[model samples]
Target chain A: MFAATMAAVLVTMILALGRAVLGPTTYDRILGVNMAGTKTVLLIAVLGFLTGRPDFLDLALIYVFLNFIGTLAVLKFIEHGDLARNAGDGE
Target chain B: MLEMTDLVDLALLLFLAVLAITIAKQRNLFVVVIVMGFYSLVSAALFTVLDAVDVAFTEAAVGAGISTVIMLATLLMVGTEEKTPSQPRILPLLAVVVTGAFLVFGTLDMPHYGDPQAPIHQHVAPRYIEVSGDEIGVPNIVTSVLASYRGYDTLGETVVIFTAGVAVLMLMGQALRFRQRDGDA
Candidate 1:
């Protein structure tokens, strides 16, 4: 049962990598990488259970937080054009 | 006789190689940076599966997260398209190929993963496993090894990260102050 689920997760991860490699537009690539990140998060969780070391879920949770924070930071950079822009700069 | 985990590990490593090649072939700088993050993401999963959870955590946070953000910010000002070299330098390519060949050659004699008879296992690992609980009183052997046995190494790593953060802040601080002065004028 764990083997089957791992296989499924591997397939999804491969597909996500494919999309990241072949996506046409920048947005397409972003979406693909983001999907790949999501799949990676799932892989870590499923792998934890398979190994009977689910105590490492803290690592998975950290990935989830970092992934969300990274994607948000990138999108905000894209939307606003700068991560370090001061409020007075806009004024 | 490959176990299920070994088979999956091989498959994931193959995928990582393909991703690396694709990243190398890409002329789009933005895509390269993002895909590098994806590569780190997958590799972190691989590390976790290999039971190196702490390494995986650091890889995901530092490799995938912080570096991606920093590189993307730098790329925004540097332009998205990669600059093409005027000509392919065969000497550099040859040097890289030679280095890669030597690295692969070096791996040929290494013990298989989790081999009980490996030299390192015979040396310090056994002692750490046997005594770290008593010495460090940590339930997690890995934590004991990292924090207690490898205290200096961990301290050095922390110092490296702290220095890097400080250096970045220093550089950025000068620029921000300059901009503020310009604004005042």
Candidate 2:
């Protein structure tokens, strides 16, 4: 069951990677990479279960927080050229 | 007998691959981003079927939530079209395909699914299942490996996050302060 699922995850990651590679725009590539990161987190988690190691849960949790913060920071930088933008910048 | 989980996992994987191909072939950028989000969600579901709840949660959050937002924000900055190039780079595409093929082939050596005698099942896993109650007392073996035997790796992973944060700050932190100073001037 786990093997089948892993294969599926891999297939998705490959597809996302293709998007990341052949993206028409930078944002499209970023989106693909972000989705890839998300898939990676799940891949790690599923692999953990398949391997029967629950300790991987900690890594997965930490990864989730990091992925979120990292994406936010990157987006902020791209949108406004700075992570710490002035309140008025959003408008 | 085909279990429902098996069918769902297979279907989702095929769907994700098709979506990816569609995104690659399409000229539209916005549609690619949206499809990518869907791809991530499906992948997350597949992870859960593998019994990796933690991974599924992270996938849904980062793939669907954070990544989509970043892509949109980036789109706002850089318009949604590619700069005209003299020629397409076929080499990069070929390289990626070859590498992916090799990886898939390598996984063939892995133990068959759910086999009780698989090395993974016979080795450290059984110990954890048996001794976790008396030793670390954690019910989840995944947690035990991450927090205990492989603690150093976890710390390294944490450091990686810290570094990424600092790097982002370094890139944007200075720019923000400079903008403020310019405004004051």
Best candidate according to TM-score:
1
The per-model DockQ list reads 0.73, 0.08
Error of 2 at A63 (Å): 16
Judge the docking of candidate 1 as incorrect, acceptable, medium or high.
Answer: medium
Which residues of candidate 2, in runs, are more than 4 Å off? A1-91, B85-93
Question: Residue B53 lDDT in model 2?
Answer: 71
lDDT of 1 by residue, A41-75 (tens): 88877777787777787787888888888787777
- CAPRI quality of model 2: incorrect
Candidate 1 yields a Cα-based lDDT of 0.85
lDDT of 1 by residue, B114-153 (tens): 8999997899988888888898999999889889889899
CA lDDT for candidate 2: 0.70
Backbone clashes under 3 angstroms, per model:
0, 10
Output the worst ten-in-a-row residue range by lDDT, candidate 2 chain B. B79-88
